[model samples]
Target: MLVSSIGASIVQTVGGAVKIHDMSWVTGSGKTMSALLLVPDGASADDKRPAIVLAHGWWNNKQMQDSNYVELARRGYVVLSIDMYGHASSDPLQEGHEMDAATGMYDGVKEIASLPYVDTTRIGISGHSNGARAANFAIPIDDKAATPLISSVYLVDNDPIYTDETGKYVNYYGDRDVGVQADQYDEFFFRSYDANGVALTAPRDYIGTPNAQSFLHFGADPSGQAARKPYTTYTQSVDGRDAVREIDNPAQTHPWGPFSKQEVTSLLTYFDKTLGAPTAIAPGSQIWQLKEGFNALGLVGFGMFLIAFATSLLGTRAFAGLRAGPAPALVPREGRGLLWFWGSLVVSAIVSGVSYWIISANTAVGTVSFLGDPPINPQGAVWIIALWAALNGLVAIVIMTVSYRVVGRRTGVSLRDIGVLPGWRRFWQGILLGAIVVASAFLIVFVLAYFFTTDFRLWVIAIPTFTPNKLAIAGIYLPFFLLYFLANSVAINSFNRFAIRGREWGNTAVLALANGIAPIILVIAQYSHFFITGELISGFGGINSIWLFPIVVILPVAAVVTRKIYRATGNPYIGGFIMACVVTIVSVSNTLTYTR
Candidate 1:
């Protein structure tokens, strides 16, 4: 009931003042793109409004832009947030589209312009990261036409307007009002390097660099000019067109760029000046944080719902036999026994962490001959994580084998104690229970998204409903993820199941830490180095390792759920299957699926 209320609240916050539609259309290129179109209440062809096309970065979809969508639409600006090709509900990116300059931004702008309720002459385009690249790519293409489609462009955490390939300034935006929300610690863009490829200075000093200087000065030489400042709009007459350009440098990392209030304020202020807001509200007066806060609340409700729903299913006659009592022996909480418990946890963390780095560096995420058809595939980030989980699961089996021989055998810990004694019938029952629980959770998610256009999310971590294609791909990778979760269930519930007589919550907390500590440490170490030294850790498997952030969030929840189910069933199979099914589906659904 609480989860349903949270879902309804999200609906009111997102759609109360504006109507959001899950829409899609084929572009002139014949490729279909998905978008969330937010049209304000009472908007019509007779009451035309300025429109903005918002795009998210790579591996993300239109839902990621909810903050922008709700705020802009509430202020009477028509907003269309699109899922770029190969991401979310959009079609897989087709062949030769990679070489095409504007992947989907041009199409998005054109779509908004065709709307009867939008002012075509005041249409704008904006994107973050690769989305910013798409927006940048579309500007010149639009400008070359006899009647351009866009009047303004905002590039967030991107570096296209500053210079061309050879580090020379170029003004290709063709006099459109432009604003660049450059971040000081952007991992990907806005840097000057020496001839030997070493960075000359930190990213915070970017405003004084030649790129910023020329960009602010309309691509003119800045050798003898006054120091250019950031966040100050400058007007220029270029190619007989009136244009304004500004650069706002936020003290944030690349991923956090869009989430910052300062970035959103910059977006609002720039559009207010360029396309003109129908309702004159202060750019700083914002309510998008309310939207984000509720979205985060939905994430909490989602986790609670999963455990509650699974527990309720276990109470029914169909699944009653799946429940078992606690193991015969608990790992001693004192002396040498305690040492073994802590020692195994440390070992598990190291094995999992090291395996993550090795697999990410060695395994390619795209289609492979060994995984069946390269075209109809479960590709990209899904493959990287599945391979990593399989590797750690193999290591876990070895560790469990040695520990049983060395200590568990004499301690009266049997295979049954560790949850390996389930009969064949019970094993099948566990699978069915897991499937039902996962399907019910997604059904609720789909209903919420279909009605309210919101899903459970906090920043980059999201639990959205998947297409049939993603579900098929999740099946392909399930065994790999299941192996890891099953082993994790045994290890947490048996090997390190420090079941204190009066401290059940503490025990579950410790187990959750043990499950997620390795990935947690990896994320900390990588970003710690990046922030302090201004460089990624050497060969830390590049930026792709950052994907582990979501894993860090997920594994702890999985650990808690595993313990909850273990307490009810006296076995780990049901919880293991549940985690594997949900995580596998999430991994495949939220990433880039390739057509090739």
Candidate 2:
């Protein structure tokens, strides 16, 4: 009853009820895949609605097409959003822990067909990047009865897997309609590849070659292959059937395309033409933003809950044993000087960026970095991030030591005043207190989710409680989180605590920037390049966008909390523990990890 009300409320917020469900099905290969199905209003089991299967690219999950789902479901088409193999909530392969992406999409098609309110004859498959390749792979396959499950397909900013050297895939796609929405300024797909698949001459012109021209024209070599065209539509015959083909060359870059209206409209236009009978809901008339905005509101609620939950307990007589010691006076309590002010930010960015680049490469998968088991994926990105955290902390220590020890002879600083290092007993007490705080927060969140069947989620941002599987994984990864936060707390507390000539706010602002400027600059540079030059920065394209803002916000927000805790307890450990545990839970719960 609670779940139904919650779901109803979310639907109303997004406009109206589009009956949504979490579903699972076993593939032909015995692997269980997870998916979300959105049923249109007023559709009975007997009224089979045209269905579309939406799959995300590498490291992404079902919510990648949130806009599409909201809009499409309102238009009366059943939408099935799947978490591909070895990702999110799917049952992953234990045999090598690696499975082909195509298999998941193939099984997703079958799942949509299994639904009572879905029309098996009117299914459309769509994917972005690697996911587009998967759709290309799955749509061409014959089911058990030798019938095609997908009648049409949409490929977003990627080459199809079926497009073999001999034009075999194009020949196969001739039976149905296909649409290509390639950003002309795609960093990797368009410019980074030659006819021979070598990664050379990047930022190359998109339409300046015979191979690309032929691809743009659906396997027919273009007479004018020497110039770029932003939009072209064509209809041709393949397999003795009229096949409609189109190539759109939006001037946008690759990374931001999936989330944009142009991309969604192009997709909707393609599906309408191919599938036929789609309701005419004009593009851009969407209320999904309200849902996303609600998510942001809930995220703010999450932070407030943590602060209230932790700070209130700390004030209790029972928890008073974990109180902080007195803060010691440090060098130049006025500030770390102008030299240290700007220097720390620049130094931290370079150190952290360089460290992340080198170390994460050893484990990153397909331009995305994280911790992985058999191979790197989004989860691997998580692991890589955790590793980067540790590396960053170590660098902070070295830099702090060097700045104090080697950089000055008369710095008026000693080991004793370098922030609070509570006595060993009190330190252990802080650890215990931190653990309780984490447990309390989780208890509250878990109850809400378990009983109400709701998570504090808004759009792409979420604060979700973990399942048993994820909780176990969190245990393995939590210590690394603690280490990073501890190092960060120590460095920021000691170095950033120096007042800006008694202007506490100014000092805090600088400190916050010092802590988070690396990611902030990285994101800024990445987006700026695409906007200014119309080309993606290539390497940071994939998973970094997920946590970009949230990850960076940690420093500024947590710095304030850390300072307050330091002011109260004179111990960085308490702040570090609390922040680390909170962030870990928030990130890990929301992220898609291997269910296996």
Candidate 3:
């Protein structure tokens, strides 16, 4: 209760400082777009204010930009954080409309511009990642329109300022003040490439490149190293307005850029320079970090709530029979037994790691691919994960069967001791209980979103409320997830159930590592190599599979939760089902959705 209250309160406090509303409107293309529109107190036609339109990249929604919305609005800028087309709470992308001007950013501009309290000539636009690409696309269209709407633009971790489609670099921003928040370790952009189409240098080396020099000098060649330096503001006059251009390189990865203080400071400084802030606060005076801390607290609270809720339900009369009488015996820690145990774990982890990389590299989910196009755009990534999980689950089944024959039969370990003999009736009841617990948890998610306009999150790991359509999508992926998680539960409860006299938590910590270390290592190795050498390490997997980074968090939590739920119910079904359902919902809802 304390954790839940603190998380909700911090969000409310931040939002209450401004009049925040969850709003949606129909775009020109006949699709609905959603946003959180924040109007500062005293904002009215009598007291007009500068407005800023914000957008998040692929696989994210409006809430992903909450820090910006809260900070900008508190500083007296009317802010509209949008759910980009094909992302959370918005209609799926239609064919031939994949890049609709700005993926709804153009619409966001029109909406904010139409507001009564907004100063028409003082509007700015900003976006991150693919959203930055959308902003890049929107600026030109808005600038060239009969009456231009945007006064300034800021793009984060996007492609080059000028696109070289016809073997000629075309500058899109005609006269709008532009700022680029280029991060040093961005995976996609701002780098010189080698012969095999690999980035030879990191983004920190970007300012010295021909592209950066040309852009910073406004299409002129820089004569000296100082002329191509970063963080220096440049200006040119066009059509009676000063078109300011500046670039700030923060030492961060593409995803990490949005969550950094350095990036936020750059934003504050840029917007203040171009559009001007109503309150002249220092760029370094930031409150977004406080909210972020509370968000992490909320994430912990969410995990605790799930286990607490499940435990409470298992104590009820309907679930009382599901509880087991005694704890299962641990696998022996003596010499040969220990070798077999550690060997199986190492082999399983390696298989899981290798299989995930191979499947992600090979699987392509699209209109023409074997999996075809899913209704939700991110289902392509989901299908890859499902195939990986299903494959691992099969291998786990084989490992467990062989281990039981080789070790368990001789040691007097029964199928019941391994949690595999929960009778069919009890198994069905456990599933029912799991479903009930998950349903209750999501009900809380809905309430939190409705009341506070917030959900439990810290960066890409989020648990947001989903539309009914997501339920149908979750159903399709649940079985594939279950095959892995249920098998995972058996492994954790049976094989790795260590008998530590006073270190129960040590056991959980070991189990968590056992379950998650492979993905953790993959992530660490990928980024570590990139940071050290300025190039991603070779022959890991498809870059698209970087989406699986969340698995590093999910698997460890699942391991811990599986053990906790097993302790409460003395079986694995309830916990496995719950994890599968929750993960499927989160995966299905947080990504892009495509229209068939």
Candidate 4:
């Protein structure tokens, strides 16, 4: 089916040439797979056009290949950006989304190469992160992927996984065109590059690493390996075909590498070299970011519309039972309390920055790629993040309590006055009404996405409509996410915004700003090093820049809506419950998950 923005493409017959289509067909696994396929205008399968299959990292979907798909397709290859099993619109299997990338890639290659329009002999495969792992699986003489259809392979942020000291695989990569792009500061990257575990400070340094030495032989001299350390190309004769091989290490992190112009252009350039471009366009000229903007805009529209729908439904008769009724049981609120405004700013930033890197650093998610399947449970990354959220929530509650109790003990403000003390009737009512109201808005949006074959997204931040498996995953993850959002809402509403001195709008403005901007500033600070100095700033590893925009979008909205919901229903429970539900559902549905 032609879904969402997959049909969106630019048909430029001149130097600009690309037409993108979104569709899914049955794979050999008999599961449906989704892809964004771009063909150069007027090119048919009969055209024997060179083709490439692009895949994204672990816990990510097809959109992560955004820049590559746009740039490569424009350069005249039929580009297929596919969602791996258990992601996006692709039908989920019982297990093995990342582990079985070979099956999926081979499925695409067999179907694509069989097409008369595509040159079966010139097909290439590309992937980043775990997708790169899958791409590695597609090559070599391994049983998982023995596809002769692959003429070349492009690896981003990864090295050949199944390899020996000489970088020898089951034995087919020596005959194919290969390119490897590694980022300087990817936490998991250097493990494959260096055997003794020393990180690379330069590109060509990879030529000296453990299994990385395998890339040196694209028909090049073994003595010249040191000179071809990273970028300087080396080629050798493998079965008489020019098995052109190249490697580039750039100044970016693992997550942000695919989106960067320098990295992505390097990616496009490699394809242009091996796959052959029809028109000679400059390597760096790109407009894929504009499409990314459209996707972001869709997310904004989706979020704002949801808030509007929920707010509107509160006024309707079907939800008449939920209209503002009574107050809730409050803890205890005294006179005008200390806002802890500056304290919050400092603490939240410290907690966020420290937790962001520490949890990841301590977990197997960091270095568990080859550790015998790594026992997939809560996903080391997910568990760490969940712990991070719960800890932050505890901090928020503690800080809010301390400030309220210590600063002012004057006049009495009951649980009712502070707005948490709603009756039992209203407490349960909030949960019931909030669920119904939030679900209604979501169902409407998801139904539209279902028929349209798309989800609300902006660039890499995606909120796809769920499959049953994803929904089930969402349910499993809900309590953990709730631990974060519920604490956040309660803190912001109950204490963070307590004792407002000015007008309601001023209070709203301050609270919203306070709630949202800290993370935005911190996120931008981490990425500033990337944009300005082209390096990952210390203490903020594994932080994907894609989170910057959406967090900025949703946090303020979370504050505003929580305020509105609290005021309408006169309690914090309902508002917190609703916000938690929406946040968890949006987050879980959009991320990558493993089948357990």
Q: State the lDDT of candidate 4 residue by residue for 461-570, as single tens digits.
A: 67666666555655665677677777777766765554344346566676677666656776777667655654455545534333445667667777787877766655
Q: Residue 297 error for model 2, in Å?
A: 1.7
Q: Write the per-residue lDDT of candidate 1 for residues 215-321, one digit (tens) a residue.
A: 88888778898877888999989778789989999888888866778888889999999999998788888777776777778778777777788788877999877
Candidate 2, clashing residue pairs?
295-458, 324-569, 369-381, 370-380, 370-381, 371-380, 371-383, 371-384
Query: What lDDT does model 1 reach?
Result: 0.78
TM-score, structure 1 vs. true: 0.93
Residue 346 lDDT (model 2): 80
List where candidate 2 sits over 4 angstroms from the true fold.
1-16, 93-103, 143-145, 165-169, 195-204, 207-212, 223-232, 324-345, 360-378, 401-419, 440-462, 526-550, 585-596
Task: Give the RMSD in angstroms, all C-alphas superposed, for model 4.
Answer: 5.3
Displacement of residue 465 (Cα, Å) in model 1 is: 2.1
Model 2 Cα lDDT, one tens digit per residue, 119-211: 888888888776787776675454333777777888887854334666543444656677777776665475545569655533335555544
Q: Which candidate leads in TM-score?
A: 3
Q: What is the lDDT of candidate 3?
A: 0.79
Lowest lDDT 10-residue stretch of candidate 3:
363-372
User: How much lDDT does candidate 2 score?
Assistant: 0.65
Query: How large is the C-alpha RMSD of every model relative to the true structure?
Result: 2.8, 4.4, 2.5, 5.3
Clashing pairs in 3: 377-593, 377-594
TM-score of each: 0.93, 0.84, 0.94, 0.79
